[model samples]
Target: MNVARLMFFAFMAMSVSSVSFAQDADCEAVAGQRGECAEEAMKAAARVLNDRYEALIDRAGSRYIFQYQSRHEEHKAFLDRLKNSQRAWIMLRDSNCRLEGFENEWDKPSYSADLNRCTAKMSLERALYLDGILPAH
Candidate 1:
């Protein structure tokens, strides 16, 4: 039950549960323009993911300050681990999306759009997963 293994399981569960093909309004509106729509969606999703990540970091810091004030080393270790976990997750997401987008052909006109769509979907899911961690105030 290590952190990385737990994260993998969580990601797998999320991916399985999020198999719907229904596109959001923004994407659907630009159905004929997938590249533009998907790029926008990916940008928006990245913003949301960053916001959630920052919030979690803030929450962790506050907890450390108010609860683990005497355990500085422990808090630092947790932060370091968190940073590594996030980095690993980002790499996994990017690699997974690349594989998904280039499965048939890498030079296809829809490759960029497909990659963006995968990135956007995974980013949103990761954001939601972050939200589920650390209870809100």
Candidate 2:
């Protein structure tokens, strides 16, 4: 009788342990899905911001070209300087964001999301700055 009771308790313990393991797996799977969803959302946001950046660049470039045609040599040099500054700004933005991604192991899932968010934020700021400088239309 004692042997049978021992076997029964062992069976119950094993059943409980299996249920616990399954629950753990389910939780991990759900967490992974949530992480993926967040990453995709971040990417979409970055793409939209990048489009805004490009639009601002187009407007600024058009303004610059118009001004250049009518300006003196000094003004033309100033415009050239602005062009150089913009190229440098692009390099800076990319490098800075890459460094942010590397802060916690570059291969991690969060790293790409961090990089995307950083790029989006920097581009948006640059676009706003360009828009502020552009001639009001």
Candidate 3:
């Protein structure tokens, strides 16, 4: 595989493993209160993810303004790609969580809790990854 594809897979593997570990730890910490805890965690992580995404979009827009006045096309292209990638990631995350939830009965509280935990874990990971790459003001 190409280096970029390999790296992407590696990162995904790490993210999945970390999410699993976090879910276990979170469940243990909450003493069998996974459902409520997962829901709360998912909401908090979503807030962080949205904030980071908006900040990055703002940064990207301002990045090319002063140093490269003639690069409007490039800025627009970057923004388009960023927005597309975020949309794709959200779809992927939802689908993956849905598939994972299939491990349990579809009508069970466990399934909902698992889905929420997965979403929370993935959102937090994505937010941390974005933080690492976001440009400084």
Candidate 4:
């Protein structure tokens, strides 16, 4: 009985160790995937925003060509500034993600967690910027 119990405990210990190792591996994989996910989401957001902004600009162009007094000139200017800010925001997000992902002092999961958070925040900011432009539509 004692021998059997010892064998069981040893098996359990090995099982736990393997699981811990797998967890670390999974964390690394997830971090990479999440980072890419964030970048792609940002790209899509930028693309859509570009189309919408161009439409607005086209509307403005038509108005000007027709010599209509643009009561919406302030709105157009605001959107232009927002577009510029989104460009800068994307730069900030990329730099921050790199900093977070490379923060591996001890080669551990904690560092990967930081990278995951960085990716998430970076992706989330794109939506927030878009919301500012289009207001939850």
On lDDT, the candidate that comes out on top is 3
Model 1 Cα lDDT, one tens digit per residue, 65-94 = 676575667678778988998999999999
**Against the unseen true structure, what C-alpha lDDT does each candidate score?**
0.76, 0.58, 0.78, 0.53
lDDT of 4 by residue, 25-134 (tens): 55467765644444444444455446645665555555544445564775567567766876787688768867776857376555555554554444444443343333
Q: Where does model 2 exceed 4 Å of error? A: 1-69, 72-79
Off by over 4 Å in 1: 1-23
What tens digits encode model 3's per-residue C-alpha lDDT throughout 1-137? 56765576578557646765776687779877878888887887798789878887777767766556757888888888888888999999999999888988557889998898889878877876665453553
RMSD of each: 5.7, 22.8, 5.1, 18.4
Work out how many backbone clashes candidate 2 has.
Answer: 0
Evaluate model 1: give its TM-score: 0.76
* Candidate 4 residue spans exceeding 4 A from truth: 1-72, 104-117, 132-137
Q: Report the Cα lDDT for candidate 3.
A: 0.78
Best by TM-score: 1
List the lowest-lDDT window of 10 residues for candidate 4: 128-137
